[model samples]
Target: MSTPEASAVSDEVTTYIANRIGFIELERPKALNALSTGMIRGMHAALDAWREDPDVLAVVVRSQHPRAFCAGGDIRFLYESFQRGDEAARDTFFIEEYRLNHAIFTYPKPYIALMNGVVMGGGMGISQGAHRTGGLRVVTGSTRIAMPETRIGLFPDVGAGWFLARTPGALGRYLAVTGETIGPADALYAGLADAYIDDTALPALVDTLRSEVFERGVDVVACVERETAAHKVVPTPDTSPLADTRAFIDRHFALPDVAQILASLEAVSGCEEAEWAEQIVGVLRERSPLSMAVSLEVVTRAEGAMADCLRRDLDLTRTSFAHGDVVEGIRARIIDKDNAPRWRFARIEEVRADDVAQMFESPWPAAEHPLADLQG
Candidate 1:
């Protein structure tokens, strides 16, 4: 929306200003703007400055890459750092990353995320929080969003428990375990996206936003919505299996436990939608058992404010780093590319209730917790 700032350009993220709109563009087009530690830290600094700068009336976030706002975090770098025993880098990445996410969630100014393309994992972490917190979240036709952490031996962290718990029906559980992709329409239907703007129209939309005037008493999100309405395209027909299977998903995933959820799926394996049930069953069977178990607990127990979920996730993430299926899953999915992770538990049934309970334990005292400052 804005011209590039002479002083704010960076290798991964660029910041600029035009007509009171501060723009943050993901600059790592090669990595699909996958977030690195430096990128998150830069965002923190930029946001801190913009939040105070009177010239900046609003903020706009998009990516230089036409194909992806952000694919995810730089997981390969995280994997290498973990393998090298550099816990500082890994911990710093998560700590600062989560803090930035919280800042975006609670930011007072109008923060707009033009989610143009592949928004997943850490990408979802940053943008989804903004969306949930009354920010301007616009998705384009190129948008393909998901929380595919189960595939990588991770639960949906980054306050996933908070947002996913709020999705329609059991769709959150269905998405968390299956790693399925959803389009703009589905994203809006599921409340993960606010509006749909076609990718081709973004330049004009950004220009309009750049030149738009803002007043102190006006609602910023509503103002953007009204401006974006002219360019909003009617999304194509909904063919997402998530929508079609909602009844089944809500019915089965309503169960509290993952093992029971599997049993519920198996119970319906002989029904009219037997193939669909079996297919989902196969998906669950393929994911990391420990991740599946912990994810269920996180989603089910996520019943409070966003800060509450993040605090819980902080514990889950730390425990996951110590003893969960992350290393093996990362090895198979990222390091080795084998797609064959030897999980600590062989099956969903093998993942005990106590195993999940262990992951929820706070590693630090409540007063010393990294995310303890976040208030509802």
Candidate 2:
């Protein structure tokens, strides 16, 4: 076998191309490789180089951290940047991050993601885009994925509107409002992952890929599928909490309005699923009312092309920083550890239709839009 050659981009991430494979590893274990703006820039540079390299037939993305592929973006950085009144700081992050997302989503060669541990927020932004492109998404028993952004006063902005909107029934709405975590079995059931292979087999799987001979005509996903099948186990569908809550999620979340969704849950407050209903209602109450309302509207309006949804998200991201609850949410939950946020709206009922509508409008013209270059 040929020896592998690799290059270090930064301490946070590393890149290498060996034997027809391009490997990008997120390397900040202490922070679980939480994406800083520099880390995003590094991955983008690697992808840009590999996109044109004929020698690189496939790309494998994973983290050096054993416990988490990535927890999310560097929220502490975002908070501090916003506080310092650095006008370009937050904008630069989202603009470049979303562009990186579009690049990964539309990359021509096979992009394989070894999603080993906690994947959420920006982590989902990167992984889910690859999953949508027929790329390999290998999950393990250790994999825990969620889009729990509403808890921190932000909507699920990293293409959640595009992909989650298309999930069966109103399950996307349920996930948006409640911020529930799902394991590998539920992830597969939700169409968020391609295969579930145990953590113990990961090294062997990587070795097989590294040593295997490559043919130009071979189907990448099929090749990966065959390799993973040797280690794949049938996860119990009943073990998934999402599976248990399916009927309740679909029925109540199908309501057109947020108020109606709440009313539907409240009406069922005394039924057999009363405890579940109340718990959901309580979660909604604790989250930023503006965030919950805007998230509902964001996902509800996610009806167009993926690029279009991303463009819409850029608008929401900008607006949220200007007038939304990001500061309060981060301050209470992350900084103070108080578990209490004094949101702009005291109650869900206080979030009016116009307030939600304002978030969906674009602040810039089509030509001037930062994401105007997105192809797909």
Worst 10 residues of 2 by lDDT: 215-224
* Model 1 lDDT at residue 371: 84
TM-score attained by model 1: 0.94
Task: Please identify model 2 stretches exceeding 4 Å from their true place.
Answer: 217-220, 231-235
**lDDT (C-alpha) at residue 204 in model 2:** 74
Error of 1 at 99 (Å): 0.2
Q: Model 2 over residues 1-376: C-alpha lDDT tens digits?
A: 5566667568898888776788898988888778889999999999999888888888889875669988888888888988999758888888888888888888888788889899988888788877756677888889988888788888988787677787777878877776778888888777778887888777877787777888641355566788777764456554567778889888899887677888888888557799999988888878888888888777888887778878988898888878889888888888998988888888888888999888778888999998987868
Give the per-residue lDDT digits (tens) of candidate 1, residues 5-95: 4348888998877767678889998888889998998888888988878877777789857989988888888789878998778877888
> Which stretches of candidate 1 lie above 4 Å from their native place?
1-7, 216-223, 231-240
What is the TM-score of each predicted model, taking all chains together? Answer: 0.94, 0.95
